[model samples]
Target: MGRLTGRQKLGWAVIAVLVFVYALFPVLSIFMTSLKSTSDIRSGTFLPPKVSWENYQQILTAEGGARDLFLPALRNSIGISLIATAIAVVLATLAAYGIARLDFRGKKLILTTALGVSIFPVISIVTPLFNLWRNIGLYDTWPGLIIPYLSLTLPISIWTLAAFFRQIPWELEQAAQVDGATPWQAFRKAIVPLAAPGVFTTALIAFFIAWNDFVYGISLTSTSAARPVPAALAFFTGASYFELPVGAISAASIIVTIPVVVLVVLFQRQIVSGLTQGAVKG
Candidate 1:
């Protein structure tokens, strides 16, 4: 490709700026809102009259009402999301390898079923799951949420990892086996290392899905025992029944958003490489 002319470069730069503003404007608005005092929120101004950390204090400090609500939910969100991501990545790696390497009956069916499950409406299944969980005594528990989360994360994990596995040359595994390594050793030592980018990318995607889930979190959990952050945000309250906890909610949102931003910033290269590797077959 030839170098761009000055005008082309300027045009591209303008478009990049526009895209950046469009993407980050909501986050910026939330940050500004988080800084506003409760009274200042009603002033209808985009920028706060005076910056206040009261909202952050309300959610983060033990003395505040929201602290109890936010802290447990934060813990649940982290623990459940990490557990679900780890399980999905491990299962997906094994399942995807089989699908990529073996010629089995119903392989297409498994792929199609996974795709279907991923797109299936969560609302449609929540009622049945709710009743079933109640009958089985799994309601309002971590396992209840984790089981449903697998349905969401597993399908896409399988698809992404399968495509990635297909791109990997099978000779590496054969070479390891020929060197006297057992099948398990060959896979663990040789194949797993090469699949790290794809696995990491899939785990991140799966965690995002589980973390952002609200429908399951709210519908299944009755208390903070298993409620994740998204669902717990709905329980935030103001000083009086007549008021809304807008600033507190905004602050909590910013806090939860920090982890996602940090993950992307730290693992951007792996994410990009994994995505492109799966897209193009060698």
Candidate 2:
């Protein structure tokens, strides 16, 4: 490609700045809101009159505020999201390997079913799942949320990993086996390293899905026993029935958002490479 002229470079720079602001403006707004005192939040100003950590204190340490609600919900969100991500990645890696390396009668059927399930509305099945979980004594439990989360995480994980697997040369595995490695050993030492980027990317995506789920988190759990951060946010209350906990909610949102931002910034290269390679063949 030829080098860009100065005008073209300036145009592209402007577009990049515009996109960055568009994407991060809401997050900036939330951060500003989080710094506002409860009274300042209602002052209808974009910037706080005076910065205050009261909102953060309310959720993080204050007495008779959101400390109780936020802490438990944060723990539940982390534990549940991690568990679901790990399970989905392991299952998806194995399933995608089979789909990529094997020729089976039902291969296409399995892919189609996975695709269908991923696209199916979560709301549609919540009623049935709610009743079923209640009957089976799984309601308001970790497993209750984890199983439903698999339904969300698995399909996309399979699709992404399968695409990535297809791009890896089969000869590498054969070469490993010829060196006296067992099939499992060959996969563990050789294939797993090669597929690490894709697997990591898939796990992140799956975690985000499970982490952000509100309907299932709210409808399935009656208490903090299984409620995640997203659903628990809804239960935040103000000092009085007539007031709102807007600042506290914003502070909580900023806290939850920090981990996601850190992950993306840390693994951006891997995420980009994995996605690009996965898309190359499919």
Candidate 3:
């Protein structure tokens, strides 16, 4: 890459701003809509004349409203996503280390197969998974959702961690052994620390994939017991036939989105390192 001229840099900056605005417009619109009352929403204003907390209150406190359902879905999302992420990261770490460090036949094939599986459309498996879960008594439960989420999270975790692992200098393990460290201790204290950023980044990615899932969540779950926030939001409605719970939906959407934003902000550096490391390698 070459350094850009002043005009070129200015042009790139403009493009970046435009892209940012394009992506941010919808989120801003949703926040603005969430703050509006029903009447203000009906008026179809981009920004509300005055902000009202009624929408949030209704969703949180009203009987037969989102609170009864939303809370469970939120819990389910958090629980399932965390569980899936933890499981995926642990398995991925081991698999990645093996792929990167150990010589074995079919290693490339395994990586390629995992890549293929990761890109497989979730919709294609929904019907079959539905039937399988029902037959196995996994339908409409947390396990149903969590099991399906593995199909998505696991592959990405393996791929990213493997890339990061490959970048590690294997000589450190030997160096630690020479220093009287046991194999397990050498790995735990040496490799683990060096790979922490990549592992943390993989965890974040896996969690996001699991948390933001809507297709599997909606397809596999029938009740609030296992439904996640994204899926539960579909069932929310206004009190009457003539009304819509747009404000409440927006508020709920914002609430769920906050966690993702916070997580990204907190782990941005690790995320960048993991992604770049993975991309730079095979």
Best by lDDT: 1
- Please provide, for model 3 over 202-273, each residue's C-alpha lDDT reduced to its tens digit, 9 standing for 90 to 100: 999999999999999999989998999999999997878899899999999999999999999988988898
- Pairwise TM-score winner, candidates 2 and 3: 2
Which is superior by lDDT, 2 or 3? 2
Candidate 2, residues 1-282, lDDT tens digits: the string is 999999999999999999999999999999999999988988899999999999999998897658888999999999999999999999999999999999999999999999999999999999999999999999999999999999999999999999999999999999999999999999999999999999999999999999889989999998988899999899999999998999999999999999999999999999999999999973
True lDDT of residue 43, candidate 1: 89
Each candidate's lDDT (Cα)? 0.95, 0.95, 0.91
* Superposition error at 215 for model 3 (Å): 1.1
| Steric clash pairs (candidate 1) | none
TM-score of 2: 0.97
lDDT of 1 by residue, 134-243 (tens): 99999999999999999999999999999999998999999999999999999899999999999999999999999999999999999989999999999999999999
Where's the lowest-lDDT run of ten residues in candidate 3? 273-282
Q: Model 3 scores what on Cα lDDT? A: 0.91
